[model samples]
Target: MRRFWYLPLWLTLLVTGCAGQAERGDSLYAQLGGEAGVDRIVAGLLWEIAEDSDTRALFVDTDIERFRNKLAEQLCAVADGPCVYSGDSMRETHRHLQVTSAQFNRLVSSLIRVMEQEQIPVGPQNALLQRLAVMHGDIVAD
Candidate 1:
């Protein structure tokens, strides 16, 4: 079982719309520790998924390095960083995978673990997750 560290803080920030943060341009990206920090978070997430039995098989035939780069780009863009994701749309990319809710939740758990490990403050982490969560319907198949 995974521990939901700082979940309340995440919820609070979401409910609050992260007020006062928007006044500063690109603060979310900066608060996310910028390019280096996002890279580390993505790398750590990949490592965690690679090591976990439940998730490892999902990436077996994948080009992990490329996936990492794309993921980092996607996350960076979502966080209002300098990078942009030129990869396929979430729906198009995962259409053939038939991904389940359980798998998606596990991936989210892995992501949260990376954010926690990197000590990315709860607000920024939740903000990013909220943005990413919109893609859930696209990525998960019926």
Candidate 2:
């Protein structure tokens, strides 16, 4: 009876270990459908931001295409995708611009719209958004 119990315990441990490893292997970006998916989401987000009069000023003087590509790359890198994020850090990048929390929240809302439009699976979307949500503190000042 003791030997039987030992075997079951060992099998349970092995199964649990394997499950944890699998979860660990999943990259945030890959879970978001890798590069192609991120591109779609970013494109939609840009469109929404462009149309919003309040947020439009933030992008004035910016080259839309370059900005879009940079954003996609950055998000991909954040998700642990294969791409490298060459952009400056959030604080360094936004320091001169003096972004406000309200503006940041609007931008995040637009991004959420894009994600919904793209129909990205919920689990990855939520996970990515959760990570991004934490950046509000550093990205938005005052």
- The sequence of per-residue lDDT tens digits that candidate 1 reaches over residues 1-142 is 2588789879988867745455556567798889999889988998889788777767777888889889989988998888778999999888878888888999999999889989988988899989999999999886
Per-model TM-score, in order, reads 0.81, 0.77
Model 1 collision count:
0
Give the alpha carbon lDDT tens digit for every residue of 71-133 in model 2.
998898778888898977777777777778888888888887888777777777888888788
Clashes of each: 0, 1
> Could you give me the TM-score of model 2 versus the true structure?
0.77
